[model samples]
Target: MASTAASASPPPAGWASDPGVSAPLRHVRAIIADHLTHGPTDPTLAQRRAWRDALYDAIALPPDVVSTPVRDGAVRGLWQSSPGARHDHVLLYIHGGGYEIGSVRSWRVISAVLARRMGVRAFSVDYPLAPEAHFPAPVDNVVAAYRWLLAQGIGAHDIVFAGDSSGGGLTAAALLQLRMLGLPEPAGALLISPWLDLTNSGKSIDDPPGYDPFNPRAGLESFAHDYLAGHPATDPLASPLFGDLHGLPPLLIQVGGDEALLDDSVRFARRAGSEQVAVTMQVWPHMFHEFQAWAPDLPAASAAMDDAATFLDRALADAR
Candidate 1:
């Protein structure tokens, strides 16, 4: 049964002393703590992009996966698949950058691993960013990408949408858009540490920061401001937590317990269930935002991928 409770109970786990925390992650955490204590507060968007990409690229992809650029009119994205991928199954991956910073290149390796491990073709869209494009632009891009996938002869039942952070927000937004457009639902969706509430109004946001040192409330506000650019933050498309989630396909929502956006996912799960949507909200103890990006490096990340692969595979297989 899906949880319709206003507040979700935190899952049982030894958050503080998780042995799965990798040496690399610990080292990275220390570095972030040090940076928080002594690094520059405001960095140019370009600088942030470069730094984020470098950090993401540090985790290598399996050697055999192939990646290629895809351009269908103004819809540009990256397509990834390994030798063993099931051609009939596809994953439309949305990269998280708080609607501003991420790119297909920045998220290449993790999506590549997702493709290889799940044995499905993966497409990561290069949606328009904020300060350049505002709300509904990226939403439109994702809708177009879905149509493009359909044009590729892939059935809606074979597709799964996966995203993290703002990309996860977009996934939820796109589902609502699809319903309004009368398009068929995909097999399912996977949301990793989704940022569903644009209002930045979550209990975790104010709770003293735990293991997460990167996501300052001020930094999130910056992304929201750039993305909204004077638009109301409560717009349904801007914040899916406020949107009606009826008739959407099954959703697997994974959020780290220590992050500010934990309530976004929890509340979303609650609301979706109220609307009778199938929702599985999984909370990882002591994890930070978008931690799955460190896949194959962090044991927790890899374990999350396994759960994702299982969910996507089953959903695609069971599609009516």
Candidate 2:
């Protein structure tokens, strides 16, 4: 087992000790923490891309997994743990990076874990980012990727969509767009601390300072504006919070209690529940948005992953 303190920096303010994380993840978290502390002053665009790819490789997922290019020549990922009878189900993963960062390579570890747990192959799309690729671009790319998946003989009913933060928002928007286009819906959707409201209308945004460790309120507000770039924030596709939840697939939302986006998840859950969508919202206390990505070593982080796995299992079974 790796030492918890081997690579760890002091816990951020308000973080309590957790015991659910594996030793390997603890080592990973420590390395990430060190990077966070003294690595780069300001990362350039190329550097960010390199960093994203490096983080993915650091997860050290199996080398035997294969990847293929998708729409716009972006890479689409596939991971299968040791050969077995292939399952009919699939998971299409869209990664989070505030719509300006993140890629399939950066989320390989997460995809691998989901693939192992769900007994299904996981596919991650490397969608275009913002500031260069603006509103509707990323969403359009995801839609194209899904269509590509369908073209590959995968049934929509056997697919589940999952993403974190901004990517989660994209997942919901993509589903809505699919419905609009008369395409078949996926079996289920999973959101991790989704940034559903680019408008930042979630009531939780009103919380006092020092509440969320990872996300500074002002920084997120800035990110929203930068990503939207003069577009209307209330557009249902941009902010799923204002969209119609009717006829959407069952959804599982996991959010941290202290996240600024907490209200976004809560409000979405309430609306989805009212619309008779099978919705489960799990809130972990004192954790920041996307805490699992930052502290994969913590017990809470692993528990969150377990929660996601269980949700996927039940939802996929029901879909079957």
Clash pairs detected, candidate 1: none
Report lDDT (Cα) of residue 230, candidate 2: 91
Position 86, candidate 1: lDDT: 89
Instruction: Put down candidate 2 lDDT per residue, 93-129, tens digits, no spaces.
Output: 8888678667776776676666656677777877777
- Candidate 2 off by > 4 Å: 1-33, 48-57, 62-82, 85-87, 206-211, 294-296
Q: How would you encode candidate 1's per-residue C-alpha lDDT over 140-222 as one tens digit per residue?
A: 99999999889989999999999988999999999999999999989999998888998989878778235454456776787
Candidate 2, pairs of clashing residues: 20-299
The candidate 2 region of ten consecutive residues with least summed lDDT is: 1-10
- lDDT of model 1 at residue 147? 92
Q: Indicate which candidate wins on TM-score.
A: 1
> After TM-score superposition, what is the CA distance of residue 45 in candidate 2 from its true location, in Å?
3.1
Question: Model 1 Cα displacement at 186 (Å)?
Answer: 0.4
Report how far off residue 317 is in candidate 1 (Å).
1.1
